[model samples]
Target chain A: MSGFSATLGHRSYEFADLRVLLAKATPLRSGDVLAGIAAGSAEERVAAQLCLADVPLERFLTDMVVPWEDDAVTRLILERHDPVAFASVRALTVGELRDWLLDYDTDAAALSAVAAGLTPEMVAAVSKLMGNQDLILVASKCAVVTAFRSTIGLPGRMAVRLQPNHPTDDLRGVAASIVDGLLYGCGDAVIGVNPVSDSPARCRELLDLLDGLIHEYAIPTQGCVLAHLTTTLRCMDRGAPVDLVFQSIAGTEATNRSFGITLELLAEAHAAARELGRGTVGEQAMYFETGQGSSLSAGAHHGVDQQTLEARAYGVARAFDPLLVNSVVGFIGPEYLATGKQVIRAGLEDHFCGKVLGLPMGCDVCYTNHMDVDQDDMDSLLTLLAVAGCNFVIAVPGADDVMLGYQSLSFHDAQYARQVLGLRPAPEFEDWLTGQGLLGTDGRLVMPPARHALLADPSGRPSSALPPG
Target chain B: MIPDEWSALRAMTPARIALGRAGSSTPTRARLAFALDHARARGAVNEPFAVADIARELARRSGPAVLSVRSAVRDRDEYLLNPALGGRLDDASRAEVDAAAGHPGTAPDLVVVLGDGLSAGAVNDQGVAVALAVGDAMGERGWAVGPFVIVRNGRVAVGDEIGARLGARFVVVLIGERPGLGATRSLGAYVTLDPRPGRTDAERNCISNIRPGGTSVADGATRIVELLTRARAAGTTGVALNP
Candidate 1:
């Protein structure tokens, strides 16, 4: 393996290989420190970044992080490289790529045109050398949109995935949260639920509930039960109304194995979801969730840094053409991110990498109670992501997920993001909200009357509380 | 003010709902309420465990004798930073375990360990009650239950090493779960058969959310006993055994 070296003042720093260089160059995160691969000092990290900047971008194409034969994620990345798109930036160094990305001339169209030419490694390497502002600025210029029942990632638009989880999957409890989110104009991305159990029967019950609600109200949004792939496939086998097949994916084959998934299995699930023909606006049927430290948590990172590995997981997501790919950034706890600042940096980096690779990236800007983070930290990250043009964000009823036991943004937080940034929900969803009189002409959520129709019974009959509409 | 109609929905679930907004933001009272719960949960994680007091209380009960030990972790920061360290015994504690379980003759039928996991409040408040109840149930079943090992700053896998050293056939670890804003002092029970090192979560059966408002101590004890009985009959636990 070839070595990389740089000198800071009188001292020289040498990295043993490309993997080591990538690990040391990554900004401070606790996961790499726990993995025992982080740079020894701040100066050493700067040295590695200096060395990483001079490396030609083409070198990433040849020097694989995980061996090509040992990992299918690597194979997919290499096999799908578009040489025609690479011809334009063939000779740029990693440093030059950073400069080019931030150049005023590089607009959304320019970034989209070269999306296929870059691999996860190239993107991850360049991200290591960029600052947080640089990440947001470049990511803001790259637009990757997709649609199902509603559109996402469109310019001047932000969506919310209504996460109405219940501890026991009670239909009425879930219904209450759904009603809260709908009134606040917050389920445009998808009305997703993280079930307490992974059983097919339980998943089917929730899916039926969501499907029925969407149909009854004629809501311009899709529904997803975040269950395992096999469980969802079983639900589909039972002829349940399945809209999206969801799974948690990782960067390496070993980590994917720990998740009980493989590339072939994902392809199978993708084809199966498409065959159902449930999508009305588009065929992107996959929804994947990734994070910074999942690979290390599974003991499958192979000495690679967590941020780089996170980018590689984006590689897996892009192959499936997912409708939603979110990084549950802080839910993994303080072990990976450690503090509020670390979580904020990671959220921006993930959004930038996924968007650069041409995927509709969202963020679950959240934190577990055990971590040294709070709602204030979440507010910072959420505002930054909205500014960076994130496709969507996960919102619960009151920023408190009683079922999952974490703090995320509230439905009101999404409205706040959209309101301050001059962003709207997906067009179809905004139209639906307007028609239902939940959105005012001024683009703000109007408080529904004490007897709104959405608060009616599950049988679609008006409750006594509902006045004649 | 909350509308009268939302009362029915609020009563259905513990989730925070119908929190009236303040112009695209959480109302001041709702935000402050959430902040208070978050502070309580964070305090639960950082609160020190009164292990000595709990050990004395357990020893006074008419069940198994209580023995106290510590994991490899020195403090809360280390415990939060590197979880792998929390899953093993320190050298001194390992020696203490070796001296306590003399000669490793016949493996005991069961070993119950009380670990102060993320929330010390969980173990302090409910750990003794659950341990004594479980010990009594196991005794009624005519099983040889070893002394309860109260571990400080311990993780779930710490029971594996302690049980393996004591030569126990099965180990049940009653520990604090990661504190949630809604439930700060929630306890969990993890049962592993033929306890040893390197046992993954797939090799254990778990009963979680044991507290006053959640799973009662009596119900948790009954479930643990049932799982143990089934494990003994099937000669396995975890993914292999049906609970």
Candidate 2:
């Protein structure tokens, strides 16, 4: 392979390999700096971008960032390439691909037709060259929808994952938050809970709780207990009502090892969830969460940049035919992202890459307290992602997750996004809300009386009697 | 006014829920409450641990000698940025541990390390109380307990090196967990058997959320002692020994 080089009037820049060029061209983020692969100077970074823009898109297919022999993700991307779809844009350079994506002539059908041919490396490379608006506009044109109990990623639609976590995994505590979210018209994506304990018994209990609520209320949504794959598998074997098998995956095999998972293990879990056949609208039954810094956090980045590694994770998600995939963007602290600007940029980039790779991508727009971020930054990212047509986002009560120790979007925030953008929840969920008198004519929540059926106890009585509204 | 039904739901959990909306957003009171909690948790992350005061308290309550040590990280900023640096002792602290181990006639059965992890306030609030309780429990069992080593800006793995240097059969690290919006001063205890430098989190057992509103300090200490005893009997910790 030939070295990549670019020049200005006074100075010239050179990168030794494709990996080096890709890392140097990436937008400035703390993860690259921590990995010692980021460009040292601003001018050097621009020059690398210039050099990368001229590289042929075909070069990505020929040269892998992580070797195919060492990483299963690389093999998955290469082996699954669709030559017929690639014939449309196979001749374009990386810069040309960016222009092609942003062109008004490139409609949703055009992008969708070529989605199977575009590799993660090709998508991540083009994303590095585009601005945030370009990322949004391109992603907004592409549509990747999945369905289970609720349909997600449909045009003019959005969804929320109601996360009602408690310090001790208390049932009533979780139920209270669920009521709050339901009142605000959230939880269409999935009513998922991150259990404090990963024990199979606790997971089974949470799963049963969510299953009982969904069945009793006849809500048009799925229930998920966000536990380890092994733990979820154990619960499945014991006859638990498993809706979606959740796991955190990474780009490299070693990072997946650090998470105590492998491709084969994920495949097994995916097959088991499908075997249960629990979907009403569709059968996509896996939920995957990925982020930029997880590979580096596990000491398994293989000298690759975080953004590319994040894109590689989408390759893993696409293989499972997952119902939902999201990047918990700012949950990892400032060591990798460092600032709000970095977090916002990473959120856009991850969304664009995942959508282009033919996956129903969402985002957990969150930040740890220790990061230099606040709710305002979260608000900015949330609105941008909404405009970018994110399928769903996590909605915790008041945006404060007491058990996970992070701040995410609140139920009100999800409502605000839907109302402002003229988007509605999944059609089935919206119809159910209308039937329950919880949605007004304008598609806004109607605030049913204090004795709403959603608040009824499992025994068909009001759980708490309160004054009428 | 906050609705009666919303307020009724707040009693179920410490989680911030049922805050009535203000124009499709969180009400001002709920927003400010969240900000205040976040500020407190962030403050706890940067707050300096009172090592000398904690050491003094441990010495007064426990029979074993108390020693203070520092990790390779020089400040809170570096501690947050470079986590690998916080997992090992500095040169001076390594030498101190070696010298302290030389005077010991026989290897102690267990060593307790108190570390100021992400939340220094957590260790400052409950480190000594838990240490003294664990020491008393081990003493009653007639096991030799080594000196309590208080580590500054240390991670959970730091105890492995300290225990290996002292030639203990087991090591228990009582460290501060990352502060959350609900609990800022929460501590966690990690137990490892046959301590060494290359141990992973999968090879250790953890008991978390040790605070006033969460797990009480006394209960945390008792659980630690029981877990360590189980680890000794099974000759393992982490996933190998069922909780």
Candidate 3:
């Protein structure tokens, strides 16, 4: 139990232990060790009591710290270091910071950094760092030693939907990036690039735009650039929905409607791609984004009640299901926040239904801020994360070629020294690679980094010339 | 051009599609069947202890393989109430998949199962693709897979008895879905690492639906090898961390 000296002499109370913090406070039993605060008001009194005895309050409340000895000192430190997330936490020493990280999850460097004093600006930077909302920091690579490896022939290939007139910058960029990344990472496993534009003519324009890239770096596998999907079409059959918009309370229906229109248009565009014989045509779908029930109100918003964005998601998910067969499933982003209680309940249902039914949930989008996601956010998201049985991530190496090259294989902190910038091998599974004795003379693994380095410098550099440790 | 079934589908109007930069695709029952048969023929798994066979054996030997996984992986009450897991076994299930499957190394030429068969409609829709992919992969790799039976069940072990009967090395079971509120009738592939019936998740690998939200066929195929290889070493799947 913890309490602050808010009384200057207001009310003095004591607490026994904290496990019952969530429970309403009661009068202290004579010999029972209890903690409470003497405050100006009832809420203040409760808040002050919570601040005493160095209670692990961050795990409890973010806005309820009281002014007391440690609370006062902690608040001062928090003011200095910038503890803005939880109002309850004003200050933390190095040890406290470590404790916070341990509680928040230490595997994430950003979380640890935030515990050390992060600014709001840093939070924004982190969210924009990756394109995928799939599982964070996840990627895997494998070697394809033989030709014609067992690759299933899906009905189509990786498709990018383009607007009617021309391929928009977003479409082209996202498509090309996905293609390039896959090509580089998966190696010889990816097929050709395709597009899904609105109309037949528009689809043709998209292809025309890709003429150069198509000719320059085309794979032998068949692909498409489809368009002209005016009528709603089915996959393999007609009963299937092309899209699904499961929703909760409505908030900003405008955005939801817009998204719906855009998806319908997407269906049309896919039809165009198919008509055009583009291996890459339109086949997109999404799930609802909700935080509440399927009401028209701001039902699905988060914390501010919910992610007002969820209603929009639900609206969208409900629109294109069983109606159109093309699976355009997507997760609602940054809206609803299932609280701890909600998380447990949801987890129970998720586990029960998941085990009982084979229909596993798919796809989720996360909008991470620079300061690292609040601990509560992680708990809320876990409910959904657990639903996606497997990870389907978009590999984003960003623009740092060296980082990309390094990521092309794998590297850890210890391997950082061997890198010497862009000179060594960065093969993933370095442990296995080294064990297999597949390394450069410098004891590095064989990878694109080494090859790229050789291309730049044929002659070896002097060890003495290099910066000394 | 649209396939005849699509054009004639009860609900949808066959929309015109483009050939775009890539050529166009024409659909026909014959084409669909051919496509599926082609892929399956290509995947004839002659190698004993094929992934499918292992998955089936696990279910036969274990109390309930896929059901156990479904119990933990779902969030919704409906899905939890009727959970589904792919029905093939892997290398690890060998220790437990009914004494017959719980043995070591390769065993049958085929193993078939059902579970939400890919997603219920897969048998009717893209079943061809799954069949083709497996058959083609096995065949090209010098294995022989039969034109086997596909079932509609919550679990995928429906085909196991057949595998044991034929003395096949593998059994490829496909199941129908429990009907997702939104995306019902989708399909996925689960390959057991060992050809056993009593095995668990550690003994299998999955190749989910061909839809956008699911794992791509190509990606799924690649992971299957590693899954098979690892399950061969570990004897389990799912939560049993893969090395």
Worst 10 residues of 2 chain A by lDDT: A460-469
Worst 10 contiguous positions by lDDT, candidate 1 chain A: A460-469
The stretch of ten residues in a row with the least summed lDDT in candidate 1 chain B is B1-10
lDDT string for model 1 (A132-156, tens) is 9999999999999998889899999
Docking band of candidate 2 = medium
| lDDT of each residue in A1-469, candidate 2, tens digit only | 8898887997878899989999999999888887899999988889989988998989999899999998888898899889899999999999999999999899989999999899989999999899999999999998998999999999999999999898789887887788788878899999999998999999988898898888878999999999999999999999999999999999888999989999999999999999999999999999999999999999999899999999999988888999999999999988899789999999999999999988899999999977888889999999999999999999998899988889999998998899889999999999988998888879877766766676643453334321121
Worst 10-residue stretch by lDDT in candidate 3 chain A?
Answer: A138-147
TM-score of chain A of each: 0.97, 0.97, 0.29
Candidate 3 lDDT over B116-223, as tens digits, reads 432334445444445545555655655544434433233554344334534555455444432222233345666643344454444455554444344554554445
TM-score for all predictions? 0.97, 0.94, 0.26
Model 2: residues with Cα > 4 Å off, grouped in runs: A456-469, B1-6, B59-63, B103-105
Error of 2 at A105 (Å): 0.9
Better-scoring candidate (DockQ), 1 or 2: 1
Q: Rate the local accuracy (lDDT) of all candidates.
A: 0.90, 0.89, 0.29
DockQ agreement of candidate 1 with the native complex: 0.67
Residue pair clashes in candidate 1: none
Candidate 3, which segments miss by more than 4 Å at Cα?
A: A1-469, B1-106, B125-192, B195-243
